[model samples]
Target: MTTSQNPTAQAPYKQLRRPTTDRMIAGVASGLGRYFDADPTLVRVIFAVVTVLTGGLAALTYPVIWFLMPEEPPTAPPWPTAATTAAPAAATTTPAPTMPVHGDRGPI
Candidate 1:
């Protein structure tokens, strides 16, 4: 008889993402305002007041939760941004004046 587990009552597996950078049409109210942390402009004003009191049928649940939400995967701008450390260092590969010379063609 030994049962007593309560280490912060486990609750850290949230995965409702959908944020390709503060989207407005398909981020699904900022991924449900960061999965219920709220304030994505209050879930876009509660989806514009439930699509104007359900007249637009609650805006059809925002395209059915943007087709069952699952997007957040584009984070790659911290190595050195500011146009990648102030840009200007990638210009050396010029060989394309319409180069396509195959003087041996026989394909019908």
Candidate 2:
């Protein structure tokens, strides 16, 4: 059935997912570019300009967006890839102990 014929039919909304590819900092611009149908470079340039014009407000907001926007889910590795299969030794190994932090130092 044609989309025009169905009143319930609607265009798919673009999700703001942080892509793993074409990322400089946190894939924010790349994901935004894909969602808004703009070039990643253009998005970056616009962000840079906004940051400068807004007295670093954009810079501060970027991190907020990075934290809010979820990273794109990892895709399954291709077949026959080394990462796809675990070695026998690796499977039998135990996790290493984490180093303890001292109060004298800054936040751990």
Candidate 3:
């Protein structure tokens, strides 16, 4: 007996992008996996097998896709720094505490 999956609901449209947050190397496999909704490990295995089978021709696609696929946007905003955030109110400069003079010795 053979079972066929009926196409019912459509998957949401996703851009072909290299994920910056979750990636191993250039993110090509991860990106393709995410785009196709498949396991990234499976994608990598397939990629390696194809690369070897195709005499490094498939491997060349890695760099090409890396160059073409845009990196996904950063998820979290950058933390506020001293320069970027508002500065505290400036306080008047205070003089250093004076020590009592000693007769050719140290502070008395």
Per-model CA lDDT versus the true structure:
0.73, 0.76, 0.76
Error of 2 at 74 (Å): 2.0
Per-residue lDDT of model 2, residues 18-62, tens digit only: 888669999999878877878889999999999999999889988
Lowest lDDT block of 10, candidate 1 = 75-84
TM-score: model 3 vs. ground truth: 0.57
TM-score of each: 0.28, 0.57, 0.57
TM-score of 1: 0.28
With a 3 Å backbone cut-off (N, CA, C), the pairs that clash in candidate 1 are: none
Q: Candidate 1, residue 12: CA error in Å?
A: 34
Model 1, range 38-88, lDDT digits (tens) per residue? 768888998898899889898887888899888876752222234655646
TM-score preference between candidates 1 and 2, better one: 2
As a whole number from 0 to 100, the lDDT of residue 96 in candidate 2 is: 92
- Return the lDDT, model 3, position 21: 61
- The lDDT, on a scale of 0 to 1, for candidate 3 is 0.76
Going through the candidates in the order shown, the clash numbers are: 0, 0, 0
